[model samples]
Structure formats: structure tokens, C-alpha cells
Target: MNTTPSMTLERQRADAASARRPEPKPATGSFQTVEPRLEIAPAGATGGELVDRYGEILTPAALEFLAALHDRFAGTRHELLAERLQTRVDAANGRDPRFMPETAWIRDDASWRVAGPGPGLEDRRVEITGPTDRKMAINALNSGAKVWLADQEDATSPTWANVVEGQLTLFDFLRGDLGYTSPEGKQYRVTAEETPTIVMRPRGWHLVEKHLTFHDRAGRAMHASGSLVDFGLYFFHNAKALIGSGRGPYFYLPKLESHREAKLWNDIFVFAQDALGIPQGTIRATVLIETIQAAFQMDEILYELREHCAGLNAGRWDYIFSIVKTFRSRGRRWVFPDRKAITMTVPFMRAYTELLVQTCHKRGAHAIGGMSAFIPNRRDPEVTERALAAVTADKRREAGDGFDGTWVAHPDLIPTARAEFDAVLGDRPNQVDRLRDDVEVAASDLLDIPSIGGEVTEAGVRDNVSIAIRYLESWLRGVGAAAIDNLMEDAATAEISRSQIWQWLDNNTVTAEGTRIDQTSIVRLMAEAVAALPRFEGDRFDDAISVFRTVALEPEFPTFLTVGAYARFL
Candidate 1:
């Protein structure tokens, strides 16, 4: 692998900063012993601005624990990220992906099972998904779902305030003191039946949380992994309390490409447990198999994290995004139709879902299904009704296919999802007893992309452009999840939207309407889309347009659109 000149310069600057920084002083609390040369940067990618509220979570002990985690695992994380690039290179060179020969024994063995769901995780029939902003957090806690996926990954834009305030939200909610007072002087509080088990989904391994910098004694400094910062801060402050409440520190691990990445998380779990005096297996994790490479190694990923693993999640959006991304440079056969045409019942997607259910059931883990983007609209009854029907049908298929639970983007769809699972799993925690013996998904079944049988259309092209521009606009303004056309658009959706355009342009794909999707078509459609969107004060559409072109129109596609966008404009 070769390093770009810009990347090399960035590394040199980080190393220089580490050489000049003094060692951090140890202080009081449980994390006093674990100190490194870690310090908070003056500002973040959103630029040099830190609010007074950030001080609540940036105490000495929390910084120490986060530093210790980086000191131990940052090196391995760097290596694994390099390995991800190698995997891509190998695939591009016609090294067809198959089940890993090295970890075949784990797949063949039948006796091994992941640790069962920890307390409060036994029945996850319906989980609400949203960002950890105060309003969203309050809604999810009382949404009547079994679990709340407090997402910081795809659904969150990592502004420094978002990063630190999310940790504080978790800490305060668990202790029953979380509240919000609006500018109009109204008070809101967390009120509910057993507050849905909070499973925080940190950012993936590829991202660097620029707000926190790790300076090691080895005279090296860099932005810390977003994954470790979210995990470390939450675990440091709230692990014991969660355990005392019989609900351990649960997590939803996202964007794992192989078993090696899973193993890295397993090692972190063991170390964090030891560091905090929590029992082994006290932390339960549900891995989201959203990437194409990860699909081929589902069994091995579970095996690596078996000691602390809970289950796997199928993502209709991100999985499709991964497919387009992994094979982006291939021929027209690998190209997909409009985003609307790539439904869940498509051949490749069905095979992925069936294999996920079968593999998880075989290993005695939950088979959680994908999330649908059709969020309900309270202002319009017709839209809400349409969303209910779509959610019901999707959740019904998942439950019938033997999924234990499913993800809903809005609270209004919770009853519809739970009803589907309730019908299939009456009086039972899960359907893991059914091993899905009838499911036989070969490597070809998972990779049968040409069998997707759909035509690319001009409307599809315009839709993709619209979604990309609108979603990126929201992201640039410090928002990760945006509602567009009754659908919740997040980073995953933006990736698929842009990657599809990049794919179509690369393959010289001709739409059914006899239109070639080139730069001219994109620019025209982008202007119309931007005009259609209602503008507000301080909107970042101009910057969003720049990001869209950089990620979608460039000859060379960046790995993840968020990385480049974060670098240039928050």
C-alpha cells in the first residue's frame, strides 16, 4: 500500500504535536491509574468552538480511561484499517470472496454458541433507532420498544458537542435525572415503563474523532478512533451502574469487514471488563453485518466475538450501499437500478437475510432484521397509513423468516413491528430454536448481483441526486438523520445514493429511458433538487453541494463519503 502525500504530512504533524505535548497528570477516581499523554483538542472539525456544557463529561478520570484504551488498541486499529484497504485491492484483482479457509473450523463446529442476551436484552422484539439528541433520546426511551439503539455512528454527525453531550445523556438518563427546557420555557423529562434497554452504536473503526487526540509516550499523536471514544467514555462512567441494574453495558458494533475486527472488539471487551472490575461477558454486543465482505464471514465474525456477542442486524440500506461500494469499479453487470428498485426481496438481498438468520440461529444468537426508512408523518394521515402498511409487511416478512426482532425508524411504527414478531413468536423470547435448516445459502447466492433483474431509469437518477444533495446538506449542518419524502435519510443512505451515481457513471450505464447519467445530467438534476428543498437560516447547501461533487462526481471514489466531508466542512 502507498500513502498519499497529504496523508504523510498529516502523520508528520501529529507526531510533532505528540513530541511537544507534556505527559498528562493523574488525578482522582476509578480511572486514576490508567493515564496516557491524552488531551482534548481546542476545537473539532466543526472548527475551534467548545461550549460550556462540554465540561460536564470532560473530567480528568474520563480522559484517563479513554487515553488508556487508545494506548493499548490504537496500533491494532491502524493495522486493521490498512488490512481493509488490502481486502478491497484483492477483490478488485479478481480474488473472488469466499468463506475464509482459515476460520472454517469455527463455522463447521456446532457446539459453540455466543453468550446469551444479557439482562434487559432477552426480548428485543422492537428497537427504535435515532440520534442521541435530547429530544430524540427522550422519545426513544419512552417509545415502548424493547431496546433503543442510541446511534452515534451512521445516524450522528460527530460534532464535538454531540460526542460529549451524548455521553452525558446516557449518564444522566440512567440515574433518572435527564431533562430538557426549551427556549419557550417548557420542561421535558424521561417517562416510561422499563426504559428501553439502551444499546449505544458507536462510530465505525474507519473514522477519527478529532475532538479527542491521543498522544503516546512513543512520540506519536493522532485523532482517536471514534469507536473507542464512544465506548470508553460510556463504559467508564456508567458500566457499574448498568451492571447493578442487571443491564450491562450493551453495544451495537457497526461496519465490521472481517473476523479480525470482531476479535479486536472482543479484546477491548476483556480489557474494559478487567479495567472496571465488571464480570467477563457482562457486556453484550450485537454486530451489524452491513458490508458485503462481512456477509461472507458472518459465522466467523460471531465466533470471534462469541464470549460477548448477542446477535447480528441486517441493514437493507447499508448492505445495498456496501454492495455498490465493494464492486464499484466492476462492469455494467455489477451496476444496480434506482434505489427504489433494489427492494428487500431482491435475490441477493434475500440470500443475505436468510443466511444471517440461519447462521445466528445455528450459533444460538438473535437474528435481528433490517430497518425500513419509511417513517410516519403525523401531519398527514395518508402518509402515516402508507408507512404503517409498509412497515407491517417488512416486519412480518422478517419475523416469518425467523428474525427475533426488527428496527423501526420512528416510534409510530413500533406497534406494527412488535405485532408482526408477536404473531410469529407468541409467548417466546426469540425463535433461535428454529435453526432454519431449510436455508442453504451458498457463496453464489450471496453474490448473485446480476440476478437482481431491474432497469435503471432517469427518475431513479434524479432521485439519487435529490437524496444525496438533501442528505449531505443536513449532514453539513451538524445533522445526521434527515426526513426527506417520508423517509429517514442517514449517512448510509447518502453513501448508497452517491455510490450508485459513481457506479452508473463508471459503467457507462444507459437508463431505460435512453439517458446516459453523466456529469451534465447530475449537475442539472442537482440544481433542481437544491431548488426544491426549502432553505432555512444558516443552511449549508453550498458546502453540501461541494461535498456531493467531491464524493459522487470524482473519478476516484473515496472509501466513505463522510470521511472527506468531515475533513473539508465538518
Candidate 2:
């Protein structure tokens, strides 16, 4: 939180530039910048010359919009994040999560509907998600899906280079000129006559962008919110362009815990549109009901962002991780079985998804389902077939249960997912009209994990350690989503994997093989995992081991391992 003397001087210089700059004529579209006082300087931690191409996306107008967003909403974001910590503490001390008594009116009111889907978001049967690297961007856009969730959050490592490059990549994609020639001399581009609609997922509210530091009114150097930076840059530069193309700035909001957080996003959207001179509801966002508390507040969340809301998504990995984090202190009563056992078929998960579909359709919003994290392996035909079949079954279940759409991490799995949805949807764009009046889920149903039982296995423990370490190493090496043993492993998955180990240790969990897991056993497993992974030339794997040790074995569990682990990048 402290700023060095040099950073202070840099902040002063930037402040002076803002003070001296004069108001400028607006840009040539409905959205424009009235004043151009923004000057961005690197925060000195990850200093490297940005590519000249980055200038195309990080224009003065874009930075000014970001500055305005930070000025208006960063304080509220800070307060909300603090509120999250307190809320978690309260939940730990027996403050049960239930539908808010005060928000019952909003939930009961069935007359209102979220502003209907914008142009490109109408029929999102299948959405491919990935970090916005150039090749992946081209592949995802070209994938035969209706939408691509261009991710900058969990799917991406927040390296300075990755952040800026992602912006530039998206900028190029919007212009319809984004393409990549692989090192093997193969070319990739958006070959489809109608490429997938893009929905960008910015970093969650908890993460910060250390590379872009701003000063508060008290003259303290503060890291910019990653959410603001990602949303600001994309919207500032591309809102009008996307609007012209009949597609607007669509987003996927992640890890929100309450309606208040959704309200914050709504306020930010309103402010951003107003500042840029765009229409009031030009932005559309789908909130990921990934947290347990968020699952309870679906209707209220939709109401908060109704004007700009697209729908709600059921996120698998993060939803499981949230369960562990929120109820870790509640003893074996909240203890989970093996991560593999808690599938979509489980009672609690089914309750959550059924309630989500009912709530979204009841409010005339699309209910998207969780990701199918199966990546096909080229060498193993058998494995690929099995994975595709599993993906098919999952999508079939979602479609049958009235989900409008779902997510796939790899392009190869898109067709399998799309086919399942097609069988249900046929000619319909979405099942928002499927009110799902037959479903009724209670608070107890959502918290019924204890009843669905299985034992922790040594294989489960070793798999958790192996996957976490591998994913963390890749993350530290500037790759957020890594394909380890055919599954797409992201920060959310890693969080679950590592946190389960922590929980198992905290509760003195006995594996099915009658072996008790303790700190020493976990350390031995960690060493074995490290030995199994192929050694690279650098210290990234070592650093990942230490980070895993801290998060998995430390006395107190950190809310998000990425928060502390990211500092190692700096």
C-alpha cells in the first residue's frame, strides 16, 4: 500500500499534466471524450517498453475514461471488498446465508424483466472461454460457437505484458483484422462468415493491477482495480465500434457475492456509458453465480443489473471453491468429499442449478450453465472420445434442465456442446420463456453437501496437489489456464484443489484407504508431484512449490491464493 519516492514523483507529474490539459473536442461518434487529461505511467514494478501497437488501444481517451472510472467508483470497490472479508468472517461465526428478508419485494415482483439481450447475444448456445492470446483469440472467435468469453481474469495471468497485449488483441479482433501465423507456418483467423460474439470477463473485484497505479485524494499510491482497468480500456475504445456492428460491449462479471456488488457494477456501467456519451443501457453483462452467497441472491442480483443484465451463469470450479472457502470453519458438517465426486448430479449442486434456471426464467433472463473443462488430446483417440461423450452428457443435462447455454474451454468441444443445446432449442433462441415453475429450492437444499457423501482418497489428495502445483507454475510463468492431463485448469480450479487440501488437513480427514492426511503427508505429496512434473530451466516451479506450501499448509487460509501469489510476479 505504500508508494516509493520515485512513484510519488511520477504521480505528481501525472497530476500536473491532468491539471494543465485543456478540454478537447469530442471524438467522432456517439461516445466521446470531453477532456483529455489522462497520462499513464508504468508503476515501476513491471517496467518494459510497451509495443508500439499497444498505443492503438491505450489511447488518451481510453486512459481518461479509466481515470474517470477509478475516480468515481474505486472507493466503493474498496469498501465492497472490505465488506466481503467481514461478511465471510460473519458467515464463519454462524451467520447463515439465506434470501435477504429486505429484498423479498424485488424477488416477488415478477412483472419486471432484464433489458432484453442485445444483438449478438441473442442465441448463446455455446460459448468458448480462454485467455485472449492472439492464437487463442483467433481460434475461439472462429470456433463454431455463438459467443466467445474472452477472459482476462482467472483464465489469464496478470503479467503486465499479458494485460496490455490482451487489450491490443481484443482491439484488433473488434476491427476484424485479428489473425495469427503460428511458429509452424500455419495461419489462423476468424474464417467463419459470422464469427462468435465476444463477451469479455474482466478480473474480479478482489484483484489489483500493480502495473497501473493511481493516486487517491490523500495522495497515496493505489493499485488500479483490475476490473476497472479491463472494463474501462475495452469499453472506452470499442463501445462505438461494437455498437456500429450491432454488437455492444458485452461482459461476464465474475465472483460477485451479493446484490450490492451487482449494484456497484450497474452504477459503473451507467457512469461509463454517460461519460463516453453512449446510450444508458449500451452495456450488457451476465453475472457468474459462482459463489454460494450469490446463488442465494440470484433474483436480487438480476434486479440490481436488470437494465444491463443479460443473464446468470453457473460456474462449476469457482462455485465448489466458494463452498469450501465460505464454510471451511464449520467443521465436518460442511466438509466435502473428493472434488471429483461433487458433480453436477450431486444434490446441492443440482439444487443450485435448478434454482438458478427457475430464477432466471422467472425474471425473463437466460440461465447459462457451468463450463465443461474437457480438452481433446490429439494422440489418444479413446481419451478424446470419452471426453467428448462426457461433454455431450453434461450439455444434454443442462439443456434438458432448461439452461439457455453453457461454456466450453476448448474449441474442439464446442460442436459437441452446441449439438446438445440444438437438440433442445431447435429454433428457439433461448428458453427464457421456460419459467420452470415446477422447481422450488430451499436454503437447506443449497447447503445439503453433508448428505451427499464420499470419502477422500489418496489419489484425490495427490491429484489435488499435482494439479495445483502445475497450474500455479504455469500461472507464475504467465499462463493462467493450463491444460494439465486433458482438463483446463484455471485459478478457480486450483483454488478448489488447494483449498480442499487445507480443509482436509484442518478437519483431520481420513482418506478412503485409512490413511490420515496431515502437514507432513501433504509435504511429501507435494515433493512427489514436483518430481513427477518435468523440470524446466527456471525457478518458476520452485516458486510455485513455495506458494502452494504457503496457501495449502499455512495456519490461516487466504481468501484467494492469487492475491498473494501475484506479488511474486512483481
Candidate 3:
């Protein structure tokens, strides 16, 4: 990391300013200085302007340090840069803070409850009608799921109408409408019976209490939970109501990006509990470690919410995007494309699973794996069996790898999946015991390269960097065409030589509707670009590319893709 002459001078000035100030403080009126400050300029800025801006906010020393850092980063491979940045951000956030010294969270002999004797599969059952629809609601309830996500997110069509309807349905289900039955030769009917043990995934942070268009029995307009409302509020408001009515539906928290974010959620849950007059641990929170940053700090995150957090679950589609975006620079090397090939059996995944299990066991929590998004075709037995087999295999692997349970997309796959998990997990030691031995390692050590096994390869690094750059470049160019190879090229490569053309287009980036570049459009455009890449020459390449594209285009695509894209560029 070499500092340019100008940067060096800037650093000196920043150092002097810092020394004079003694204590760091946020800039405020009157106290604000005209002196240069260190700032992260948006990526498209020219070197001269960037330097000039650096002089304005940063003290001499700060400027020099930043410049030196910038020099070190300049022209470096994307993967290396990404790794360094990831490391830097981790350190800054105190992500690996040491709360205790050399005390393993999981003891070798410690044990916890396993969800099943073998592999256990939980399917997500979504209800669209309002809670008042006991017949339909109970049907979903009786469908047999280890977990049923009462979606307030994408599953519902029109936001306003669905929210109130969904909430009411939940209320009824908890109260008494959940009784259902079907005779041997009869169609399934709601018989007012209730079944215990179904987990709920509430709507996202979109809609909570606004009035919507659900009609009452008389068919007149009535107020209900709207689509565009905050899900947290909805859960907070209804959790007690449902529990008071004698139904316990645990929650699955979604879209979390970091441990800090998880902590924030814990805080929110606490606030909700207090406001609702519920006990602190009454509402169990499961944090979705879906982002790249979150994946790296799983242990700390789990620790942060030890008391309130119920468990952790991997979000496969989101996690994949997180990986791609987090390490996009290395996408060209086929690491990301060949992720399935890498096998969840790899040491890195093992480390993650191990940490997850360790963290959960330490806190007496459940460690759950995410869903296998396999949609079975009931008409086609082969397709159904294949789907079931894939899910069963995943559950077996997860249970063997120490996950207590896993999720499935369809109800039909649940029985088999659960059976598989139950078979493997029968009377095994809990994950807590395993993690107890490793808890003695410092937080930093837990996240260090040694704990994760080998250093990230150059090819891996490059792929991440390339993917990120190409995605961004394609986004800027209104054409929505991301070149996979562009990320692999250095300044000396032909691809790099042609960078200006794309940069210019990106600079003038606009939407098909001729609107300014918004984040949503940028994401959609990036996916299109990535998808438009020339298919590579291999059987796996076709499938990999298709999977990548399909996952990118899914409704939840935005949550993961944006994070993935940002991880690379940042």
C-alpha cells in the first residue's frame, strides 16, 4: 500500500488536526472545519477530483493514510480488494469483539435437543385469505409442516387487501378456526380442530396497519392490514393476541444484513415485548444470515442476540446471491458458478455450519438450515420424487453436518424430508457440545483464515471482483448486459482497455422508461446483464447460468442481489 505524494501530505495535515482535537467528534455547526476531510467518494469520480475532495475534509494525516490505502488498492485484483475491504469493515464494526477470554461456548460433552431422530423437513405454507377464512386457513394448518410461514411478503398479491385478511386468518387460526378434517373418501374440510407446532414467517417490513380493501360479510368496505406496512409492527401487535388465544406461532426474521442488524432486531423485539406486556424471551427471534457480511460474523451475531435469539437459518437463494455479490470479483474463475460443485461439504461451509451450531448450542438455541426451493409437479411422479430426493439428501447432509432442522418449499416434500433428518439425528449429541471446544478461540481467531482453513485463492478473488464490476458496468450501460469475463481482466487486458466505452454508457445510465437510475432498476438491469452473458462451453455452465439467472430474477432477488452487488464494489 504506497501513498502518493499528495496523499502523504494530506495524511500529515489530518494527523495534525487529529492531534489538536484529541477526541473524535461528529461535525456540527460552528465546529465544522473548512479543512480537508477523508471521505469515500462514489466510484465514478476522477482521480483529480477525488484527490481534491480528499483535501477538503480529511486532515493531512488522514488524507495521506487514505491516499496510501487508495494507492495500495488501485489496480489490485477485485477479490483481494474485496477481502481487504471485508476485513477492514469487520474490524471497524468490532464484529469480532472479545466478550470472554478462552472460554469455549460449546463443551465437548454438552448436548441439546435435536429436532428429529433423522432428517427433519419443514415446509412453508402460505395463506392468502384473511384470518376469518377458517376453512382455508385450517387447511393450510393441517397440511403438515414443521414450519408454516404466514407470509406478509411476496406470497400475498395485492398488499392492502391481503394484510388485513391474512392477519384475521391468523387470529382465527389461533382462536378456534383451525379445526379441520377430511373423511377417507371426502374432500378436506375445516372441522375446527387445531394442531400444535407450526412456526410462522410473518410478512416483511412492508405493511402493518394501514387500511386495505378487504370486504366484510356484508361485502362493504372495511379496514384491515395493508400490504405496504411494516411486518415487525404487525407481528408485535398480533403476537400477543394469538398467544393469548392459545396459539404459539414462532417467527422467522428476514432480510437481516449484519450482526448489528440482528442486534437491532433483538432490540425491536424487546421493545415489542415490553409494549405488548410480554416477557423478554417470550418472543423467540430467528435471524436470517442472508448477506455476505452476516455470513462472516455468524458467531458474533448469534452471541449478540444470545438471550432473545431463538436460532439461525441459512437462506439459500439469498445466501447464494450474497456469495456472488460478496465475492463477485472472482465470479470469472467459476468458483461461484461451480458453487454446487464445491459442495456444501467444503470446510468453509463446514466452518459456517459449525459456528452456527456452536452459537446455537452455546445459547441453547436451535440451528436450522434453509430451504431447498424445489417445486414439485404433482402430475409428474418423477419430478416429485426428484424434488423429494433432493430435499431428503439436503436434510440428511444438514443433520449430519450438525443442523438440527431444515426448511422445504412444498408441503408434499415435508414428510420425506423430516423422516430423513429424524433418521440421522436420532440420539446424537447436540451442536452445543461441539462448539464448546472452539469457544475459547478469540472472536478474531474464529473469523481468521486459519479457522476457515485455506486462504481464498487468487481465482476466487478475481471472480468476485469481476462479477461486481461487470454487474455495475452493465447496470450503467442502459443495455443491461453484464460481461462475465470483464471482471477477470486487469488494466492491461483487452477487456480493461474497453472499459471506458461501458463506463461512458454507465455514466449516462437510464432506464427503459427513461427514468433516472433507481436502486431497483439498477438491480434488475444488473441481473439482465449477468444473464445475457454468452453461455460458456460446458454442460454445467448451462445449468449454472440458468440457476444464477432464475435466482436473480426471483421476487426476493432484490434483497440478495443488491447486497451481493454492493459487497463486490464496496
What are the per-residue Cα lDDT tens digits for candidate 2 across 1-570? Answer: 111223333443443343331122234655533332334555465553456687776776677777778767777786677667666666776787898899999988879999868989999999999999999888887788899999999999988788989998988877878888889999887788888888999999988887666654434456678899999998888889899888999999999999999999999999988888998988999999999989989999999999999999999789999999888767778878888888999999999999999999988888998887777898999889989998999999999999999999988898899899999999999988988899989999999988778889999999999999999999998999999988889999999999999889888888999998898999999899888777868748889999998898886677899989986664
Candidate 1 regions off by >4 Å?
A: 1-35, 44-50
Which candidate has the top score in TM-score? 1
RMSD of each: 5.1, 7.5, 17.3
CA lDDT for candidate 3 = 0.42
Runs of candidate 3 exceeding 4 Å displacement:
1-139, 154-158, 178-198, 202-233, 245-249, 330-335, 338-343, 427-570
lDDT of each: 0.86, 0.85, 0.42
Comparing 1 with 2 on TM-score, the higher-scoring candidate is 1
Minimal lDDT window, size 10, model 1: 1-10
Residue-wise C-alpha lDDT for candidate 1, range 470-494, written one tens digit per residue = 8888888888999999999999998
| Clashing residue pairs for model 1 | none
Against the hidden reference, what TM-scores do the models get?
0.93, 0.92, 0.51
lDDT of 1 at 521: 85
Q: Using TM-score, rank the candidates from best to worst.
A: 1, 2, 3
